[model samples]
Target: MSQSASQVYGAVQALTQSSDTLFLLLGAIMVFLMHSGFAFLELGTVRKKNQVNALVKILADFGVSAVAYFFIGYQIAYGNNFFVGAETLAQGNGYELVKFFFLLTFAAAIPAIVSGGIAERARFYPILIATFFTVGFVYPLFEGMIWNNNYGVQTWLETHFGYGFHDFAGSVVVHGVGGWIALVAVKYLGMRKGRVRAGKHTNFAPSNIPFLALGAWILCVGWFGFNVMSAQAINGISGLVAINSLMAMVGGILVSLFAGKNDPGFIHNGPLAGLVAICAGSDIMHPIGALITGGIAGAIFVYLFTYLQNKTKIDDVLGVWPLHGVCGAWGGIAAGIFGQTSLGGLGGVSLVVQVGGTVLGIVIAVLGSIVVYGVIEKCSGLRLSEEDEFNGADLSIHKISAINED
Candidate 1:
């Protein structure tokens, strides 16, 4: 057996594929754990009565998202499908299937982000329908455009702007799309009942700080997988992405600590803002550039979150719009700036193309969300019945509380 060159080559190839499959599987599991982060984060932010609903929505939406992306979204984004026999599907250690698993987590995250904004008052099933439409249809189009270069978008960008838009881990594709879609859903749902009375806003503080912090920590840890594993192959993994992600996360924390004046909520969310922003550029950005990008994202979250709550009637429950939407957009643009060679990055980025691509994702998200959410509202209704809202999502929807009195 050792005498055959062909046998040795095949053995080596098989080993490489197996190793890569294992790497991506681990990454998928880590990102999968972030769903729990989403659940706990929403649970701690909403009123206590809505805690059960928060947990339920994350789990339920994940199920729906998995089905949607597997059957529909993956094909739409990457133009691949699972319409083959089991033997054919299992080829190459089932790497394609595992890829589907990893990317499904990202697709599912869009709905999770939206879940945060529309929590408390939304009807459960309609929200599921929204997730189906988004993960299955809307998000995939833009994902294909930038990531897969569908529609010649990257080619066109290169022809005109000298570089294709770069989003290493989907600052614009995932977070931007999710955040803007949440904005539309929030707009359609309107403020939680009596969020503002007599032109004065009423603030509802987070229900449990410990849970919120725990959620933040989980997401922070899981994000390393999110960024590093984007390479999809172990050989492609880079220490730069890891270090950049770290710098950005702390950058966000330090900036939010100062800008938010030590507010617990802002402090907890600060790292998320940075992480979200750095996702686009983590591969190419220097650590210092990542820190600035992340720090700015933190400031954006704190400032815009406060402004939206106080200066406007937009009742985004967890400030998803600022944390994801605005910060994600900032990350997209920041990548263009910081990815320049002069800035200690790998370069080959164009700022104008970055803005254009980011805007494209936003426009698609906003329009798609409006139609999808609007149709859902017209048919099944989007919000809970007033009685249900007053009683809270837990008792009204789930028929129990997070804590039970036996």
Candidate 2:
């Protein structure tokens, strides 16, 4: 090759490599902080009796996902194969590190999402076991199918339809997966003690709103990495992703502020709704499109949370389904609608296909988790005893009490 041509090639390669490395590092750090978000969010929602259990589950999830992702999750999700001929695992150097770090964030998110459903009642050891299977096998398998360039959903989409199923970020893959698991967990664990009785109603308010707000803020900040870094190429699109994410978040806040009739919980959940709504299309959406999408997401979350909690009686303590699952579906569909090549040269997909993919993801995640949790419940018992639950899982499972009457 000519010297000038070689120089251009070398420069392009270096820039690509640098972008990948920088985004990977930044994304990993941001995602790690989301654990703090989970901790405080769960702690704020559950009663004080279960505070320690919430803390332990969040901390353990971070640690467990780290180890599990390092050993197997990475290989399964981003590895070249299901079991063998995995190039990322072969040398364990170069781009492998980037892939590893990226997958770690995803793995960590799974258990954190489910913690909301099983809050205040599940046995600690069983929760840990569920996290193990989730990160180690279930998440990896689905993630690999969607993300791994050669052998998963991308390949399938390419072969069948000329364009691939584009997630831009991981609305269905990560958030959707986690939300489904949470639903299943709640079903298996049943409602908190005295939450429902002979068709009567009861109120279970959050223990601390400040903590919930703090967690929500952390999640909003970390989402920058979660969405922008997923570009996997951190040049122009990365900046666009960041802008879209912020726009959506702001829109969500504004919409919720108005829609909530000045309710703090609705306002606090707005940014989360926005974050979920933009995850699938952040890289592709115009600023206006993002803003609208986020605003709608925030409004929807406010309504859904009330509807689910009050009417349906699905006690999602942290509103994971509304914030993550429902808005995730919105984001996925928005990718198909608002996405435009003319805006930024990012081609849009068919709305039909996008909706199909989104629905498929939700169904699989919900049903799969239900089956898995059902088996676990039958085999080892998932819920704590009534006495233990009433007293609190913190003291029952960990032998630690949050109350100190002294």
Candidate 3:
């Protein structure tokens, strides 16, 4: 090759690489902000006594996820080889850094999701440990199967079914996993003090509305990066994903407002429902399809939240299951319907395949969470003592109190 030609090629390659790096970095930054949203939202929902604990857990989860992803979780999730040694590390070198950022956000999510359930009473140290195991190992394993291009479950699905289970962003992988974990954690932790007394129930109002609203807005903003950047390409498709995400949020807002008789709590959760619902097919769905999908998700969130809170005794402080798990399922299924090429090159696979994938993802998530939480509870004890529960984990466990001293 001529010297000038070689130089030009090298320069172009460098530019492309730099551009890709920049996009990934931006996506990482946005995903990081989601932790803040989760923190503020959770703090708003729980009583003041648990505020500090919630904040600390949110911060600590990010740190734990970072360390775990760097050491082994990244490799386990995306590496070409699974053998433990220098050879495995060498084979996994190039992808480690990118996987670290991607999986760290994912790991952070698991703890964030579970935090709501154990709000008000659980010990801090144990919760931290659970976060470590969840993000470090459990969450990564599922993510590996879902997104890892080389040897993931997606690959198996493609080989066996002739069409891979699609999750353009991570409805089934991220939110679904988090929701199941929250369910198990809540079940194991039992109910918050006074939640059930002599067969009667107690109502717990949000401690701060402004905080919740701000958190919801933050989540809505971060979702742009979550859905659009998942495409990993900065072109027309990315723009489409961004539009879908926005539309979905708007749809969620409208649906929740109308469906719930203008309930503020439902309104706050509606945007999340839209985001989660659209995640499965955000990359491919048309703008209008996204609206419908998001609206349905919002409605589902209202229904599930009410059912769980009023009909059942599940004390899901932040409604993670309804917002993430159920909506994630809706998103995945919506992809199968709206992804039809007629809509925007979305649905083509048989309905049975789509349903199977959704069912399989949920089953795996639920069972995995059950086992992980059960083991953690047995080993370290998941909840605080009765006295500590009354005193609040923030004070009893962390030695810091949110209460003002006279």
Candidate 4:
């Protein structure tokens, strides 16, 4: 080739790489904003007296997760770390740095999910410690197994079942793990004070519905980046992922509106439930299949949340188990079913592998949370004193409440 032709090719390659980097950077920012959604969602759900703690915990947990992932978790998951000089780190178009930012947002979400379940009573620093450990160690372990194909789990699955587990994004990996971990933490921390009495659950109405709705809206809008950007390259981006996400969102909304009896809280959370379920299959499932998957998730959340809170007295404040744990697991399995050619999907998934991978993820999450939270519980204690609980987490921990009158 002539020198002029070579120079032209170099320019085109540089432009493509730059565009991909920009695409992923935007994705990281969008997922980062979801942390605020987590905060405000808890802020609106918890009693006003505990609202400040909700905000503080989400922000603090993100800071801790960033530190942990930068130092250790990213390496565990992807065999890469920012240990070298900044000059060297910037060599790969800084794509690795942006990728870390994106996955770090996901790692931070574990504590954010647990925050809701253990809200109104958990000690702040202990939960932060849990955040550090979870992001640093627990989450990255399985993240490596699936996303990075570490330890040959995916390879083994593919060999045995003719396809590996197919979580295009992270339905089982992120939301499912976070939700199950939250369940264990909630159980260990015990119910919030006055939440249960004589086998009955008390109703604590959301303090600010508008804040709750705003948070849900933020998460809903940001989910496009979360799903679409998982493609991670300009050339790999897909209109199908975006459309599947939209269909699932509307399906969740419509179903939850019906299933939840028009409750505003449920209606807002419906889209989130759908998004969580569709994350695993967004790349492979048809839009109509995505709708069905999301509709089931919406109905599952409403019914199970009621049963867990009332009959089982689980006291999961935000219903993370139903919205994330179960629905996320369902999403993983649904990918195997709905991603089949027979189901009008892309057809490179297996039901057995999907079920196996989903269950493995939940098992790892449960064991990790139990060990981490159990140690924290025994050592520094996890819950507030009864007196402090009555005073509320905002006043007791942060020395302030959401509203005050002199």
Candidate 5:
């Protein structure tokens, strides 16, 4: 090639890299905004007295998560760190930095998910420590294995099952792991004070329906970035992923409307259930298949959440286990089913691998949650005192209430 041709080629390549960086930056921003959704969702779900604590914890957790991921978690998961010179980092149009920002949002989501389940009664500092260790160590372990293909786990799956595990956007990696991890924290922390007095479970209503609905909306809108931008490049973007996500969201809504008996809480959360379930297969599943996957997930969330609260007495505040944990696992398996050529999906997904990978994720999350939360409970304690609980987390922890009197 001539000198002019080389120059033109270099310019085009630079432009492509710049565009990709900007695209991913937008996606990172959207996913980052989803943290606010997590905050308000918890705030609206918990009792009025604990609303301020809910808002504070989510923001604090995000800040801690960024620090942990930057210093240790990102390198452990991807075998790269930011210890190099700024000039070296600026190469590749600083895409690596923005990519870190994108994945950091996903990493921070682990503690954000757990925050909902253990809301209202958890001690502030202990929970922050949990966030640090979780984002810094536990989440990155499985993340490395799945997304980064560390330890040849993906290779082993493909070798054994004729295809690798296919989680296009972290059904098991983010939502599954976060949801399952939240379960341990919830169970260990136990029910809130008076939550199960007289052998009867208390049915606490959401403090603000509009706030809850707003959270659901923000999450729903941001999910496009979560799913569609997993491709990580403009050239790799697909309308299929976007449409599948939309179909699944609608499916979750319609199913939850009927299954939840039109309860506003369930109705609002229904779309989240669908989106969680569709994350794994959005790239491969047809829109119709995504709908079915999401619909089932919606039903699962409503039914299991009720069972957990009433029968099992788990006291998971936001039903994170059913909505994210179980639904996310279902998504992993559904990807194998719905991504099959016979199901009107793009093939090359394996059921055996999907199930195996999902199970691995569960094991990692469960063990990690147990060890981290367990140690914390044994040492510094996890729950608030009965007096503190009665007074509410806002006044007890943050020294303020959600609503102030003039």
Candidate 6:
């Protein structure tokens, strides 16, 4: 039997939609696993006394973010909702639904970044509230502006600078904002007990180097999904993003290995700095450009982290600001340079526009964090009690240690 041409076209459309839905779902799952990476990373960094708390907090925060993003964040960012009837919702192979799941993972990352900075001393419920608030409100505002062009923000940028800010996988949108917000959290939470002496950090070393390495490895592996799957559909996927991400990661590892003077902590975290920086330009950048960007991010993390600990006495527990905030901003700007055709990129970027966007994200992050965290601190307190700090977050908040005994 001969079929109508329209029927054939419709069939092809269905198949494409189904394939795209599957692709995004896989990406969401991979990103979902990165939360565990967050868990183990913090778990490995803090003392064993606070290990259990670190694990519990990250998992719990994911739960909070899910609700906030689902109920509010998505609507604010893209002006969409899932309130339609079941039959209507089932259309397009549930592609929109899967996309929401994928982006929810990104929104959740904001709190995950904050978790590392304020670990060991923040009250659990308060942090959860802040996570909900930021993911639901603060992050989506800027995310909508840049990604969705809400309130003509992207339009304005392109009109004035010949290009809008281009963050292929959210260096500024996610990592930068998270990192900056983390700085505010850490500042308000203050240093852990015995963490400072006179004018320097007390230098409490990582509790579990193996766990730290494991966490880094997980995130490294998962980042391919983070950058590649960012295409969000089968047709848009590109191998350039994958290779770029790899080269950048390697660059970070080697650079930090040398710059850090054989410190295992820096060696593991080096790739992360690279990954964060490459997120904005991975799709547009050549492999060599990515390597340079990653290497620079690694050096930035090592040098600044050391200076903060040794001289400034800032207690950014895991150096989230350097690794994510500063490196994330670098990624945003690096895209403007590396993504230009003259430098082996696809070239739809402007350095001026990139800088403006980076600064805007940072300013939004700073103001939003101050307002949200400050209000919470004043209303209900953000940190654990002095006694709780001495006893560790595990024993103080959860009533159990990572290793319990009779």
Best by lDDT: 1
What's model 6's lDDT at 5?
Answer: 81
Each model's total of backbone clashes: 0, 1, 4, 0, 0, 0
Candidate 2: where is the Cα deviation over 4 Å? 1-19, 80-94, 149-152, 341-345, 403-405
What local lDDT score does residue 49 receive in model 5, on the 0 to 100 scale? 97
Give the runs in model 4 whose Cα sits over 4 Å from its true position: none
Q: What is the lDDT of candidate 2?
A: 0.80
Q: lDDT rank, highest first?
A: 1, 5, 6, 4, 2, 3
Score residue 314 of candidate 4 by CA lDDT.
85
Cα lDDT tens digits for candidate 2, 165-225: 6687888888887887788787777777787777875758888889889888898888887
Q: How far is candidate 4 from the true structure (C-alpha RMSD, Å)?
A: 0.9
Worst 10 residues of 3 by lDDT: 90-99
Candidate 4, residues 1-406, lDDT tens digits: the string is 9999999999998888788889999999999998899988989888889999999999999999999988999999999977799998886688878888888888888888888889988988998999899889999999999999999998998888889888888999999999999999989888877777776677789999999998899999989989999999989999999999999999999999999999999999999999999999999999999999999999999999988878775889999989999999999999988999999999998898899999999999999989999999999999999999999998899898777787
Q: What TM-score would you give candidate 6 relative to the actual structure?
A: 0.98
After TM-score superposition, what is the CA distance of residue 2 in candidate 4 from its true location, in Å?
A: 2.1
Query: Candidate 3: misplaced stretches above 4 Å?
Result: 80-96, 149-152, 235-237, 343-345, 348-350, 403-406
lDDT of 4: 0.91
TM-score top scorer? 5
State the lDDT of candidate 5 residue by residue for 1-406, as single tens digits. 9999999999999999999999999999999999999988888888999999999999999999999999999998999999899999999899999999999999999999999999988999999999999999999999999888999998888887889889999899999999999999999988877778788888899999899988999999999999999999999899999999999999999999999998999999999999999999999999999999999999999999999988876989999999999999999999989999999999999888889999999999999989999999999999999999999999999898989887
lDDT per residue (tens digit) for residues 81-141 in model 1: 9999999999999999999999999999999999999989999999999999999999999
lDDT of each: 0.95, 0.80, 0.79, 0.91, 0.95, 0.94
